[model samples]
Target: MKTPAIAGLILASFALFSPACSQAGINLENTRVVLAAPSKEASLVIKNSATEDLMFQAWIESADKSEDVPFAITPVLKRLAGEQQQVLRILYSGKGLPTDKESLYWLNVREVPQKSREENTLQIAVQQRLKLFYRPAGLPGKVTEAPQQLKWRLLAKDGKPYLEVTNPSAFHLSFAAITLRMGSKGFTAPIDMVAPAATTQVEMAELPNGVQANSLKVELEVIGDFGGILKYDGAISG
Candidate 1:
């Protein structure tokens, strides 16, 4: 069975192969969007980096697959000239969304390129998706501290080793990499995001014949603001 994150990624990959007029060139100013409380709106800057003009569409959807959304994006359709930029305004209606914890959403930007006059030429459109984080005011703790506060444990079930991670805080943690170190040997798990107040178990590779789980040290690199990675270290539970 595939995990939720893995399934979403598969679907996104399938979307890239759909029919399109041509390839588009664009640049997003940020990899993620953060909307804090008390602010009714947020801005995302998108630039058409190619020499030719391009048409684009932008929208927001719940990352959890919910139908009802609490936010709206302005100028859903736009035509930008080469080297031109547009500011996408995201406004929160201040309803139907949680005010106690951070909520996760996805912002999708699709580029529609112009068709070529030459026949037998294929065109491919590009779609970009970024994480959208809605942070409510007065959260118990800071987001920067949430990664280190995660509860970690190593366990064996059905003769297989697994690493369990639990996020107790009300902030979402997006990890870029997770490494498990035991003595001089180390194992790395694929990157994944742990939602606030949720738990995820990552299956580990076969351990050395005599190695034990309890002696391993866990290290994770989380995606931070401005596309940086923040490192955290922890030890497995007894």
Candidate 2:
């Protein structure tokens, strides 16, 4: 395997670690990787599920797609023979990242299949993209508490209802579902995730009949650090 460049790397939308094998027959042990300031590195297990040979190339890119990345990956490119697994380690630089909040990055692992011996056969190179989080040594609250610490409210723009939220924690919290619960009525908002110390607003779904907007409870399904879903009971601010 040769050193591959980040340039011309095709990326998939997004994927989580699962027991099901991928199109390229590659599987990751974890959905995401996290590196703390107290730690020097993190590792991921990459496995080739197929019985044939496959080439896997792993790389890191900033969440904002910045040119400068403060991390490096071991075995940037490797050939994994049938049903074999390899450990890919990610090393973080001591500096160049903000300590005030968790930084987000992407780990892109692309599977390069062996050249086709059959004539005119199609071979698709599959790539798996997972989220990577860089956390500082000391944060105000726990990662599990981030979802409940968020400030949620209902805002109106041009008579259209919108959901507004602010993250007070240094950790980035993602919401899989946000619902405004009322008496026998529920109006779900399409808002997904919010950044740390960031205020985000998204237009909510239309209010159902007989649903009162004055007293509404916020029900959030948060995505935790290890890819588990957690429930949060909250209320809108006055």
Candidate 3:
């Protein structure tokens, strides 16, 4: 019989030759829209599957009815690991809304790779419809009174994402143009606003990587402010 040291070496060699194990993966869960008690900012949840650990990143893009739209990342590129999940949030403000109300959007989630290569990278993309409308809240010349609440909704239109804004104030809050700013990428869209109670939507642009999808970051800009200070929603990429 072989000595203990020789036997140990043989066992170690055999273990090294063992095949890699393929574990099951997790699915996205609990994706729903949430609105604050008296605010326009909304929060959405992204749950992961219960199988293997995962890494992911988030991004937003513009969608057009008959053309390829543009999109950008909020934080450039990011990485996520398995068994762990992250929450991607976006703030909705009415800006350059299309009068057509037929625009769409695609929210993308991509998986990061343990090793970097063309074949090993995987991506998952979710397409949503966008509907955003806004109107002023509070009466004009009422300085002492609280501003009326601006009603906003990130709607799930036929299993898609959309937004609408409602203004309730006497004064007109101009929401003329919308600019989608992601990382160093920018896209401008022209639109008109209604006084006191206008409803409209802006279509989303296509992602950078076409159908395959990748990790990315995103931010939304309406007229002047950056969606009332809520910025950036993202995920991991390979």
- Clash pairs, candidate 2, are none
TM-scores, one per candidate: 0.87, 0.85, 0.30
How well does candidate 2 score on lDDT at residue 176?
Answer: 83
lDDT for position 10 in model 1:
17
State the lDDT of candidate 1 residue by residue for 84-189, as single tens digits.
9999999999888788788998888877646665444455567788998999899998889998899887777676777889999999999889998887877997
Whole-model Cα lDDT of every candidate shown, in order: 0.79, 0.79, 0.35
Cand. 2 TM to true fold: 0.85
| Model 3 lowest lDDT segment of ten | 1-10
Query: Model 1 scores what on Cα lDDT?
Result: 0.79
Error of 3 at 107 (Å): 0.6
lDDT of 3 at 166: 55
Candidate 3 structure, TM-score to reference:
0.30
lDDT score for residue 46 of model 3: 44
Q: How much is the lDDT of residue 193 in candidate 1?
A: 90
